[model samples]
Target: MRALSPPVGLPMLAESDLVRQVARRLSDAIVQGRLAPGAKVAEAAVARELGISRAPVREAARLLESQGLLRACPRRGFFVRALSAADVDELYDLRLCVERHAAVAASRRLTAEARAALRRQLGLMRELAHRDDPARIVEADYQFHRLICETAGNSRLLRLFDGLASELRLVIGLIGRLYDDPHEIARTHEPVLEAIEAGRPERIVAHVDHHIGVAWREVARLARTLSPTPGGAA
Candidate 1:
């Protein structure tokens, strides 16, 4: 995937809170291949480049390390994790399984407020997603699915899903690469949300299954082109 430049019109914050901001910037760089797999990350140089102290850079690397997006080697420094087709498939499949059940359960408890909120998400996603920018499309896609999981109303599952977001992103980003049609994605979403709001559990499940299967196929199709082997890289 190409480098995901910070979105236009993003709010600017100061450097006082450097750790998380540093981590986020570096994480975006890794995800977008500004920092490619196995590329060495130097804490001092990163700090120098960003005009900050090394403490935050080290902290950022440690954060990424915990997320499995970075690793340290003997006598070497941090490096981006290698992208893998198998890893993406397994993560996406697991997400599909969790979300399908959540959708069905959420349908049984649908409320007016939840329906309105979901409808808002679908609309916002449709608006931003139509742009040619993959980053915006992918960001909207995340909000859309996360909205579903929230409507599902399982606190534990929501936390679990949040924890797995980075892995979730691998396939979601791949989906944007696979298909250029945002209207298609947005159009298909209405029926799915409609079924959920109508309290049709069976239809909700089928809708969930359909969406996941379609998204999965797109990810699988592009992941193959990513080349499974990083070959001596991270």
Candidate 2:
């Protein structure tokens, strides 16, 4: 199977590491739309809800702020940052560059075991899609793409792709209901897998670029629709 880059220099932080645990939970809430775009995030409220002190919660907010998932206002509390259409376009463009390289490289170097693992991820995605759980489906979709990066055998490429995971989750959360069939989501990925399995680098690159391009357009459309007009209600 394709190997993930072993996390480097990460000191052991057990589950009891309250700050990180709190941060992860908050991040999940944001990525799953439990916290909506522009919704105020109060440190005290979150701390009260989670049965913790405010310090860790405040630290967690700062962590998310660094990731562009939260924004701090001067007088008000932190809020979920609204990703604009331009933001979506930039994210997709960067993703396209990284994934195209990974797909093309994986086509040339993918092993049989890695192919099997990739197929397994795709199967999991199909199952998640059928269950109609957007959060799980989005995660599965990310895992499948991550496997492709792993198959590329480039540690730097995998690291770059991993960096985008949080923002990608934000995009998926924004889109909400991805497709009517949901199965269509799983099925659409097949051609990419097929191309990679065929060991055709050009085919893999073309398919990846096209796939991401379509997703970019859809997100951009949704962003424009949701964006407030000059005189419109936000």
Candidate 1: list runs displaced more than 4 Å. 1-16, 36-45, 130-133, 228-234
Q: Which ten residues in a row have the lowest lDDT in candidate 1?
A: 225-234
lDDT of 2: 0.81
Note the residue pairs that clash in candidate 2: none
- Local error of candidate 1 at 6, Å? 35
Question: What lDDT score goes with residue 175 in model 2?
Answer: 51
| Count of clashes, each model | 0, 0
Compared with the true structure, what per-residue lDDT tens digits does model 2 show for residues 100-209? 99998988788889999999989997888778877787778888899999999999999999898888878866655557777777887899999999887788888887
What TM-score against the true fold does each predicted structure earn? 0.79, 0.86
Give the clashing pairs for model 1.
none
